[model samples]
Target: MSNVEHVTFKNRDMYWEIAADIYYPPNFDESKQYPAIVVAHPIGSCKEQTSGEVYSAQLAEQGFVALAFDASFQGESGGEPRFTEDPSLRVEDFRHVADYLVTLSYVDAGRIGLIGICGGGGYAINAAMTERRYKAIATITGANYGRVLRETEGSAEAVIAKLEEIAAQRTAEAQGADWQVDGGLPESTEQAKELGITDVDILGATEYYKTTRGAKPNGLNKTLRSHMGTAYGWDAFHLAEELLTQPLLVVVGDIQGGFGAYRDGYEIVRRARSTKKELTVVKGWSHYDLYDKDEPVAQAMSKLTPFFTENL
Candidate 1:
């Protein structure tokens, strides 16, 4: 069984509390200081989903202290304007997790590492850009939400129009109208197809986030409509070419489309200044496969286990 302990701590820059699940290594000893890895969940996901149930659980078994946490404004974390997806705040959440980890006597602060999945991958990279506490960083199916939205929103004019709409929505909310939200995946592949979504990655997201396979009570897959403006204005790898110097490991599926995680993985690795970096492209696997698929997850762990072990 995974030795997980539920905990909560206040955010570094914000008044909200962050809820998290810490997974201890087998034969865990509080008297001993262990290297720690902060695990961040994907956008619209929580600690109880793949981040805690799969990745953190597996990492703990591999002999590292693993932490899976919900970002502020999501899951059990305390934040206002619920379900907002602000990348800047999300990046700051990682720093807050690091702050909490460093205070624990059992965690070796200098040897701290990071692992982020999907959108969390983007945030992790962004966090490591300035937070030098993380000695090494890794991402599975890493996705840059801003880049994806910019490229996929059809055209520059279309994107600008969408942002204008988002602005109007925010004004409406401020004027006492209810907060309109969007970006939730469909309940099933059939529904997704009916909605004109045929991308393999999005279809796979439906399979994972909408079903019992990866679904959790706290992972409802919604984001505030107004938050899209912030997401659209941000970039996860804004200064990675200069500031991202930690050892990097990028794991992604070979699948070509859906949300561009595959593309983002290669792009970030190229942009990062990390001298020691490697990108492992899992053959024949799609973006969502790495989320909870046994074979891909195991395959990713094979690279991840050694990467952290050597770097941290």
Candidate 2:
């Protein structure tokens, strides 16, 4: 019923195959090259879970060549120590996708763009900084993973201390203890409840991550290798000093828990020397609103099409 077609392409390594769904425009022309957009999913989620397919399908109907693929070590991609998370490798995965995109006869290499959702947004920005392959980058309900994990909501020093503790845990695992990562969301203490983050936050996130709404068996979260910190160490703000030459778009929902991060990122980009950037805060939308069938999805696409159309 949709214009999208399932496809698979081999990465540089034979074992690292990219599983993607290509959405063709209803009026697609075989002889014409089209602007291409690569959609990346969130950490611990697949191309399917966060509705990357839905976005691609919709973009295709709008006359773009949109491709959504699973990151290596997640979903249909092949990697060892399955479910493991690596920031550098994830960024490389995006680069590889860009490389693959340029090879497509129907793709216009100069017009390639990227859209990252949730955690993937962080990866995409980082990728743009180093990859320079994407002509434009856009993020929805974006997150800066390194900042979120290393710096807590209140105090940076206190958050770093906690990260050091997590590092110690990784050390213990390397020395042969079972790799015991946090199972689910932490139990909400009384103090947390006072802050309005009752048990509901944990429970809701768990349900979202563990159900069909946002779950993939192979997309389960796993502890990073002990050395992974070296790659994910730099906060998203670290790159703020560098000029964002390409057009950047940041989209956030008003009600998401991590909405503040979106603002933080936008401010950083605004400070950059780049003149081509825009930010949109969707009112009455929650964190998960951009993930699936929420009204904000339509609002996001409406804004995204024009931005990429003009920029890419």
lDDT (10s digit) by residue, model 1, range 86-141:
99889889889999999999999899999999999999999999999999999999
Each prediction's RMSD to truth: 1.2, 3.8
| Deviation of model 1 at 248, angstroms | 0.2
Write down the lDDT that model 1 would get: 0.92
**Distance from true location, Cα of 115 in model 2, Å:** 0.6
* Candidate 2 CA-lDDT value: 0.72
- Tens digits of per-residue lDDT, candidate 2, 42-126, equal 7777777664656777777778899888888668887755566677778788877887888888898999989888778878887
Candidate 2 at residue 148, lDDT? 64
Against the true structure, what is each candidate's TM-score?
0.98, 0.84
How accurate locally, in lDDT, is each candidate?
0.92, 0.72
Which segments of candidate 2 are over 4 A away from where they belong? 13-15, 153-204, 219-228, 256-259
State in Å the error of residue 300, model 2.
Answer: 0.6
